[model samples]
Target: MNTSRGYLVIGGLVLAEAALLFVPVAILGAAINWPESLDFAPSQALPLIDGQLGQVRLGYGIYLVYSLAWVLIGPAIAWLALGRDKQVGPLFVVAVGLICAWALARAIGIIRWLTASTFLAETYAAATPEMRQTIDLIQSSVNAWGGAIGEILGVSLFTVGWLVVVSLIILRNGGLPRILGWSGLFVAPILASPVIELFGMEASIFISTLSIHLWLFAAGFMMVGMALFGKEA
Candidate 1:
């Protein structure tokens, strides 16, 4: 029932979720390589060129679970922080919105990857002349799916916008460090810009993407936990 303790519990849960989510990345990396001896061209393995179908499936599943956790618990933590303060109410709303946007984007990305990968892999195995043409059609469909995902990424810029706003709220309320708050504000535009340029541009901005999201998630967990359980400084 202690406030700081609640924050710590939330933080611990986020960290634990992150660790579990990260494992699938390693698993996918290790299991994803295809054997050259398989003699199937990349086109044949459309779903996953190497024995990566299983890995993709597993990774996407893990991502889904973690994404859901973030969407649900993230708002609960934010509510805990902001609900009592009338000034913080807007920030809580922003946090909830951003978390929802991120969750939706993540879900779309997972589905796109799974569907495209599976279709390609199945078509690759059937490589008859007729199947080849069908494969081409499927490939086009996959490309369209990619475009759709790009749109989702673009729309998801709201996540960064909300984070920046929430960071400011946290700083103003004196619950978290000013440095982190400033970083979140500064990082938002950089993280959000890639969504607009994603179609034609290389997504190198995802470096910032990783940085911002990780920081927000970690900081939210720690700050909330401490607020819930820790003694005042």
Candidate 2:
């Protein structure tokens, strides 16, 4: 397909992915009364975990969709990059590879939690002291090694790489607004989240969520503009 059609199609998919995430967040935000941090204590998670994981399951289901969409997004970005005739530099290749790999990691983390961790949480809520200890050991092991560490590295690397690569693309190619390119500079703190957490600043989670969503919103606006009006370019 021609560049314009390519842009239109990929752009729409990105927007749809963003909506898939956004809508669920909005609904879950209300259902759960919108916890400030995405991380919730076992107590906070207990209600939904007990009831067929009603709201929580719905939210996680959407997260699964979000995860699946990321698989598409990495390739979509590459399609846009190639359509714009940008150099597919080593950095570009590395960024895309990391994004794709981490996308899978993210999927695994979410899926594992949905399938196992929540069940463990339900068990923990009911188990006797001795049983609770076993559940804790198993749950903590899954969280520490299976979920937390993997997702931390995966999210940090892919997101940081994503922002840098997209910034470079927008700055170098005129396919997108340069202001948007400059905005990509905002990803620095997100990249530093691991270090930030080490410093006891858990606020990095909120910052990362806010900024990335804003970035996606801005990108969607620009891309949809291209789709509707600038498709001939």
Candidate 3:
């Protein structure tokens, strides 16, 4: 495809992904105080799930869609990059690879909510104290393992890697506004802030979330403009 057409597609996808973030955020945030709820112990979390299983499932189901869409954006960005140069650079390859890993890890993290957590919630609701203890152990393990893959690996690391690489490419290529590129660079470290949790420090994920949302929103519009009017300084 031509560059304008490519930008159109990529821009639209970026904007859609940015907007789609709100669905799960709003739904799960209301249903279970999520994201924060993600950290709740089984005794606390299971009850919320038991009380609002439908909302929890619905929120996560939409989240699954959002996460899977992340995969598509990778290839779209790769396509745009390749169209510009007619060859893939190491950065492009790395960006696409990280995006794929991000999508998969996020999906794995979300699947627990839809499938395993539902069962655990139901079992916990009726379980005796001993059984509840076992359930707690199982749920905690799931949260730790899945959280590591999804939150730390996918959201924090892989996504940040993609942003940094892509931003550098944009800065060099002038495919989008240079300001957008700088903004991406500015946001990349903040996006990776959640990774600090791995070191036993509390991550202000809210700040990261706000930074990324603003960056994506800005980039999305810039891309659409580039599509409509061609590249600009």
Candidate 4:
């Protein structure tokens, strides 16, 4: 329960969480894109999609299971590393709240993506020329409004909430350098904003997401290193 050992445990858990992200990303990405490939040629990819969906669902479920581990274990680890005198109660409460909000936002985003993708594929395939024109109008309306709502509320809430909560933890605990935490906070608002207006024009989902993942990985490492190296201070 010394600082060094505490850090190592938390750091290891963080890395494990990062590593687990790849499972669902790989599986779900394949599942989402699999149907598109079916149009190119007669192939076995359709079945693969079905199979991947099962895997993705299972992987996502597992991910959710472990989501609480870090937050719960982290404070305890941090307490031991930096010493029991540190006031980590607020940090713990914030972390838990952020995790819950993130989980809810993620659920909303996934539902939106799945619903939109399925509707587009089914509706587009079945429509006659006249129906297609009508449906196109509907689609435009839906996308314009629905997409805005989903992006703004679902995605933004999760991303920004995560950035703020994680940054606060680091800043409060003095676990990692303050600059990285500040940088994360700065990036959060950009990631949360719509990618159309001038302020949000330069935003790239890929870059933003990748950067967040990298920060999590680094934070995890820092936690583990502190646990394994630091004395009770």
The global C-alpha lDDT for each of the candidates, from Candidate 1 onward, is 0.60, 0.65, 0.84, 0.54
Cα-based lDDT at residue 60, candidate 2: 71
User: Candidate 2 lDDT, tens digit per residue, 134-194?
Assistant: 7766765666554454346666666667777767766766567677668877764565475
Per-residue CA lDDT of model 1 for 1-233, tens digit only, reads 56566566666665676566556566555665422212234464463543567776776677667666767665764554452343556667878887787777667755665676566766567678788777767666665565345334633465676667667666766555555567777777666665655466544443654666577566656565466656421
- What would you estimate as the lDDT of candidate 1? 0.60
Worst 10 residues of 4 by lDDT: 38-47
**lDDT (tens digit, per residue) of candidate 3 on 131-152:** 9999999999998888888888
Order of models, best lDDT first: 3, 2, 1, 4
Clashing pairs in 2: none
Q: Which stretches of candidate 3 lie over 4 Å from their true place?
A: 81-83, 230-233
Q: Output the number of the TM-score-best candidate.
A: 3
User: Mind giving the per-residue lDDT tens digits that candidate 4 earns over 1-233?
Assistant: 65466567667876787777666566555565522432332123323433455554565455455444445543443343233456657655665565555555455444533455345445556567787666556645554454344445544665466567656665666556566578778777767654453354534555555665687687676666555666322
